[model samples]
Target: KESLDVIKVLTSKVRWITLLQRLTLKQLWVARNVSRVSIAIWKEKSQAVHQYCARWIYNSSIAFNAIDNDDFRLFCEALGQFGPGWQPPSQYQLREPLLNEEKKRTKEKLKHLEEEWETDGCSVMTDACTDMKRRSIMNLCVNSRGGTCFLGSKDSSKDSHTGEYIFEYIDKCIEEAGPLKVVQVVTDNATNNVAAAKLLKMKRPNIFWSGCAAHTVDLMLEGISKLPGIAKLIDQAKCLTIFIYAHHKTLDLMRSHTQKRDIVRPGATRFATCFLTLHSLYEKKALLKNMFGSDDWHECVHSKSVKGKASYETVMNIGFWSSMTLVLKIFSPLVKVLRLADGEKIPSLGFIYGEILVAKNSIKEATYQMERNYEPIIKIIDEKMKGRLDAP
Candidate 1:
């Protein structure tokens, strides 16, 4: 030991590392072996911990990002302090063998659905979208009592989407799925799609042709949006949202006034969004009026701006609020119908037609049994419904 201390002073690294030959050298070699054995044990234990944690996460079906949560991190830290350190599955395991196992299980579960498709029949629903590649892609799915299964997608970038083209494509899909297994085909209410439905009616008479209920209701809202009064109301409402949100300070003030609830309510469709925003404005009428009339608003630079002055008058406009209430009376129930048709939960098919009727009654009642107020709105609704949703 004394020799090693003297050697330490002689070394450039300022520490004595080498074991002098004989008695001390054997002790050094035994210490190295113990260190190596401890590391090996820890590595094996860590791998086992990772495997266990990965299986638990998979079985529990928690979100993948749950591990990033503050609560979950604290929970993990507590375990590491008192229980055991855990590891997750490797990327390879998640992507390869585990993925294959999930696929096999999904297919096995889908077999019973295939049997139901043959017996109860399914709806062949199609929707089109533009993918990131700038190609128009059409997706096909089969919806039955069991569940909805995605059949596949096709890039139709080169194909024309004419009535005849759509009919032929849908007919082929039906044929491939077994024509008897398809009870109906549902698509958007585009002119080409309507034409395609007619062609399908002529050829496959047993298979019903149903317009996409949600799209149909959206078109109804689309028509109502073009009405002179509703159009002006929406324009003003949009301007109001734009003015408040464009300035962060004003937005913060507005949030303080409204208890953090935003005045903008976006719906599933743009047309729906207009009505929803109007509904939001109506609901926050008191808050907005209070905001515009506040001392803070008077002190702010925006309060004196042309836009701000206009916004104040707009908020205080009695006729504007009246029109908004009237519009919502007629359209709010329809928005509910649109949501019902758009949602997947609770099998909305049976409820939609009944709800549409309910919405009509609601509009009528909203007008206080006076035909004059509701008549024009009903006329627009009837026009959109006539040959499409209303037709036998």
Candidate 2:
């Protein structure tokens, strides 16, 4: 109770000190010199009476920690209440007339940053997360050439998740950090994301929007897995991968014994995980072969044949490899074009237009290659396997 009373008194004293300081500073500005004897009397009688109270208040207030003795002296001088030996107060005059001038400068700086962002060809990346209470999409504006420019969010209410709501939030972000000029929005290929991308494209025809490369890869893998006879093989591969991850100690023991190699970590690549995952698996094929060769894993190996000859052959064929290679080839040129678009050394519209043409051509070339490779597989499956097998 006493502590609470002390706090109340301290708060009131701080308020009084602030008022006194402002009043003193105003008077000091008006009077350059005041009589020392008169000042001394005021200091001894009035200032001294308040000194203890001022000290108590100062110690209590957070801002008081930042105030210096010189500032206190200036406050005294401003009031025309300073004692002898005290220095004159510092000038409070500003070179700029208004606080708004500083704000204006800051706004201009922000504009410059925005311009830089636009010139580089920004990409928006979005992801959704659900907390206990709500689901939100975290949208980040990234300079395709480098760093993140801004981050914003859209929240879901009443457990309703819709693309329209996500896009509405994106539109708000665009309005806030706008000239609304961006090159592309790269997002995961969820239904909501696809809808949002389509809406953004309709609203801003100039912007280029696409699914993220990582997401595109995921879709490609899923599509490939859905091919006739491929699903079970892929599932088996996944189960084996999961089993290895789940039985870490057993995997470690195996590694320490026969192979004497390091245990493969959890989330390690499966042969059918993705292009990158496949690449990793290809690199570690010998290790994988050894791991599955053990007596306990013989059944998993035997089940691989049950997924069908066509699925295995299709996966191993040049057509699938060619298609993947073509995609990478197309992406390479597009990535370069995006980088050039974002750079400070702005290219002419004609040059940029030409680069866009090149990107389009690269995509066409990839599509052509995919069809070219796919046709042979389709013909072979039709002739040899009838409708029992499908081309991946």
Candidate 3:
């Protein structure tokens, strides 16, 4: 009625009817646009929720790669099982009740290992390393039927790394690990560590001390590197690498020729790195030949230098190649042993003795059963092997 009264002021009622039709169409268009806008907003908000969760993960110092873990996916799926309208636990709940409950569950998982500990026993492992602050820190752990479990670390920055100082820490760790449950202690074969192990053995007649097999093998590799032939090879290889890598253009040229494969193969230890680098060099023999002979190398200023000429000659030298082959044959078997001793795949303790024998046989075969060529190498291996197999 009010609309009609208002329309009475208009000369034609058709005009008001036409105006109402336009208004209805405009309202419908606005409603449709609003619906579309709401959908876009929902999608943007959905993506933002994921970003928000990721931001929390980053802020909390969680590993970004953990998002790829099956556990993480399962965790999300488990949460979804709680269904909609269920909120996550609050920060206080996570800190108090949930944390306490998680601690209980974790402890429960270790209960099964108690029987293994009482029966087969365990070995306490003390590993000393330098921190980012350059402080000397030793971490204590125990390995048994349950695998390795970390005890803790001690900062020995001030104390001298003598037998007595080390023994005290080992004694404390042994007591903490339940002395009767620990059968052996393992550490690097440093002179001080050896002295410490001796002291530990004297103090605890029931417990034996052993050297790290990996460290012993690494020392063997070190001895090999110091050999006259090996020393010369390493020095020449280092010189060649320095000449190539020290310069931008030559390094780029070398990479291009070798399809970007680096000649420097770094390993866990310096001596192992030497052998690995030798292996890399032997693999790229043809590539190195082509690189040095290329017009690109000839055009480079480094090619005219004394270092460049020496590098080229070394690559070209048949004698160098021969020595490298002989050294690799000896070192290749040892490298495999080192890897096995250092690795955790399938309990290497039982397989180590057999593997060492196999490696020695492999070395003999590598030398074509020539005793004269392999005697010196075998002597070095025997000296290192004694410390590993003969120890606890």
Candidate 4:
């Protein structure tokens, strides 16, 4: 190692500035030539290659929200480190010239998709979201046997998202995507969105408007969570969560009992979080029983407080555990359907309607003869699905 270090020092002492400069220039020349030749080859290979590459970067930017000018430069610079033959596209090269090029390619592709869909038909799914600046944006995406593609987006903050306004937005998407090509439109179960769907159907009777299956199941969960019996249990569960998590010592004791798992897991939706919170509590039932009986719990001063005592007693109550079971029995199916609907691997259209039926039947069989218990839950799901046109 010492001899190698000495050899390295001796080699470092040599003046290779001119050689290094020549190598750098050669690399630059090679990179420029490769980039130019690559473009020429891309042109010869057909526009599909260009479109495929552009869609990859564009979709990645939208999916991860990480493609900025600086990020692009860093990505290209990192790639440049490998070899001069592998030149990277500049941000401007992508954002401006390549962007326009891709747009043209996309239009051509959209035209082709529209032509193909003329016979088979496609579905457009519309959703509204607010960006970081609190600006409402309307986005439209289309799916068919051919493939799925984003149609367009518009800033809708200024406009009232009335049925007519949304209908117009849908119309514009249809016009761009080819009106005759779209056979169905799907949106959330919001009243205005429902109205918009109805209006679009009136205009384009041949096209169906279906309510989003994911949103429908979420609403079902929301309704079920609000039932008086379930609501009380949820409140107790939340109180227990707050009491334990609010105090570090109690939280640590909880971790010790449950092998460091919180009694509440974060969820993407409100009802989802509510059910998951209850589910977590149910999972930690034994740990919680042990916790209330533990020496540390008895010694803790907060344990004597009204909130803490109430929470501890709730955990000890058999009725609370029973109520949790009922909650899970009624709502777990909705969670299942939610997962099935939100899945990406397979198309959901084939299974969602059938799953809704199975979910209803499972709950019915679980709570049979307890008509009072199951009636409201079944009613909510039925009413949500009624006339919503979810069938493929």
Candidate 5:
């Protein structure tokens, strides 16, 4: 009874009963009553059999390139060496056959996904990224009750990637995912993507098309950055940064003056960095002006340089300072709402509509209720939002 109990526990750990039925008679003989002295010869064969299933799973769930790393295999081997039940999967097992197995499993999952979609609708999202080879790949994913699942990916390098081309892919994904069960399609606010969304909407009038909010706000910022005054300010700010960082002496001096905080903070995007740099420069106005006016600044050769003169003049220009202040005032409200949409902790859908209204009103207030100044910026924002499907 004690021996039987021990065998049951061990066999259950390895799924021995199922494995035995699947094995040939000789393999079954080895699986059941292998001699301990001959076990070393069978270890590799036994390991391969057990690890074949594991290899398929790893290739499907994780990255395909993971099997290429010798370190990963070494780590798995070390675990198998220390642990008793299983062995490390060979890299060969992670190749062609494993990929085919993964495809089989994917078909099963898609069937499950379709079933879920029948009960609860799903949303599809498409995003394009350039892989290591610099080939453009469009990834299609579906979000259902089971969470987001990768449906497929298409390489667009050979394709036109126009609005019509994008729509074809979107339409195919929608069809594969069950068009009747799809609630919406989400994509970035790129020109082609927006056009694709519009075409998709026309085709399936009931399904909503959601343009990415973050991308829309970024477009708004991009439009603002193109304004003549804003463009000039950004150029001056970049020149100031280049001047300060070019010479070590001025860099140290500026750091000391500003208490080691850089006036130009890096941002994820070019326009974002431009605005953030402008904001930082505006905040440290006094310190920078004082630095330029200091006795040490007079002695420094950099202050006498051509670049230095331009930076100093820009910093001292009252017009430039006023423009910076105005830009900040107009965009700060929008930035706040953009942050809310970008955040992950809380869902922004609940407050985003209200927030946009407040933001537009705040911009009017910032311009001191002046129609001329505020109206243009408001109009730009409105046009951008409408184009991106962000407008109510």
Candidate 6:
């Protein structure tokens, strides 16, 4: 009878504790929901007011004490889930005036962007679609003279041909954006893009048509890679990069084991393999050499050996590095042009014109040098080919 009474008492106590836990959990959920609704209501009323009230509520000693004393410990625990980086408003008093100032600044920026679009020498157009099948074309204008550039977009019908649709969209843009004395339109060599360029040239005869240098470079790079071994070598380099980057703990260990070189950051998968290879050579040469001499490297290289040898020779050549250095040196003047254009205190047109003249001279000099370098190589190849044909 005594043992039965003791068991009954223990069971009853366990039930009470379980019920208490359940009630606490329910209260916490309800509190969180209430807090969320209150925040929503406050936001609807005014962001400034809501921010101010939140600041006060978070900082008040009395509120903290009340929370500490109550069965609302679960609610307090829920509140603690807010991120440590959260910060309340520093100056709530200037809220209205700040908002007004921002609005005025936005209007000024739009006005400036529009003025730039009207006078810009170069522009680009591209299109993208949403999940809802709503199609839109984006037009971006860049003034070589320097100022706020314009970006505008418009929607098109779902069934509309992308090329004709984009052309119509461009026409609408020109009408809305005002007279654009553009000197060039740069785009990818897409059929639609080509048609648009032709149409634009017909509409504005004075405007020169040119393909994007970046796009041209991409195409050239792609063509070069397709030459047997180059693409495979590039792929092997990419795989090596993946091996190094994918395992963070291993990468960290490698860094510690090596000369404490800067570890690659998280989410940097798109980093160029060339740079990564150079870094490995400079910082972790021993580890890289070991890995390169392993079975994995042999397999990757052997799979594309015929092309790999030529690709490796091309990449490792001193001439390739010289060419890269020369290109960088040639484009160095554009950095100054970009800096001058981005100045907040707008410089006079004469100052801008002077800079443009300087840039034009630099470009002319660079082009001359490039032509000079390639002329000898071109002449030799041509002469050799002609001699062979004549002999035959």
Across 1-392, the per-residue lDDT of candidate 5 in tens digits comes to 99999998997978876776667777867766667646876897789855995688676897767667898789768877787776545788778777789889978987888789889999999999999999999999998777788888988898888998999899999898788899988889889998898898789988888887767777888887777776787788789989999999999999999999998887755666777888899999999999998999889998888998998898888998998898888778877777777777424443766787788999899889999877777887898878454532
Instruction: For candidate 1, write residues 1-392 as lDDT tens digits.
Output: 99998777788343334534554879889999999999999999989978988899999997889868897789778778875455667999999998999899889977888899889999999888998989999888888998888888888999999999889889988997889899989888999998999999999999988787888889888887777877898888888899999998799989999999998887789878888788888999999999999999998889889999989899999998998998888788999998888886633555677788899899899889898767777788787676567643
Report the alpha-carbon TM-score of model 4 versus the true structure. 0.75
**By summed lDDT, which 10 consecutive residues of candidate 6 come out lowest?**
383-392
Record all residue pairs in model 2 with backbone atoms less than 3 Å apart, i.e. clashing: 24-78, 24-79, 28-78, 120-342
Model 1 weakest 10-residue run by lDDT = 12-21
Query: What does candidate 4's lDDT look like per residue over 1-392, in tens digits?
Result: 99999998878766476679889999999999999999998787758755775798787675434445686669656865775577558999989998999899988987777777888989898999999999999999998887878977899889998988999889888887787778888889898998887888788988888887778888888887788887888888888888888998889989999998887887767888888888888888898899899998999888889988898889899999997897888888888888877777644565788888888888987786488878998898988777663554
* Local distance difference test scores for all models: 0.86, 0.53, 0.86, 0.83, 0.83, 0.50
Best by TM-score: 3
Predicted candidate 6 versus true structure: per-residue lDDT over 1-392, tens digit per residue: 99999999999999999999999999999999999999998787677754665687787744645535555567445555974575544576458766788779877876766566565544444444454545444545544454535556455444454566556666665555543545555555456766776677677776555543223223323343343443454455455445555556435544555556643432111222243343343344445444434455445533255444443444345554444343433333433443453445545434544564465466457657576553443343233223111221
Which candidate do you rate higher for lDDT, 4 or 5?
4
Candidate number that wins on lDDT, 4 or 6 = 4
Query: Residue 154 lDDT in model 2?
Result: 51
TM-score of 3: 0.79
**How many residue pairs clash per model?**
1, 4, 0, 0, 0, 2
TM-score to true structure, per model: 0.73, 0.42, 0.79, 0.75, 0.70, 0.42
Alpha-carbon shift of residue 147 in model 4 (angstroms): 1.9
Question: Tens-digit lDDT track for model 3 on 1-392?
Answer: 98887777674778888999999999999999999999999999889979998999989999889889997899888877876787879999999999999989867766656668888899999989999999999999888978777788999999899989999999999987789999999899888988898788788988988888888889888876777877888899889888889999999999999999999988978878888888899999999999999999899998899988999999999999998898898888888988888876743555777777888898899889999867777788788767556654
lDDT measured at residue 73 in model 2 versus the true structure, 0 to 100: 64
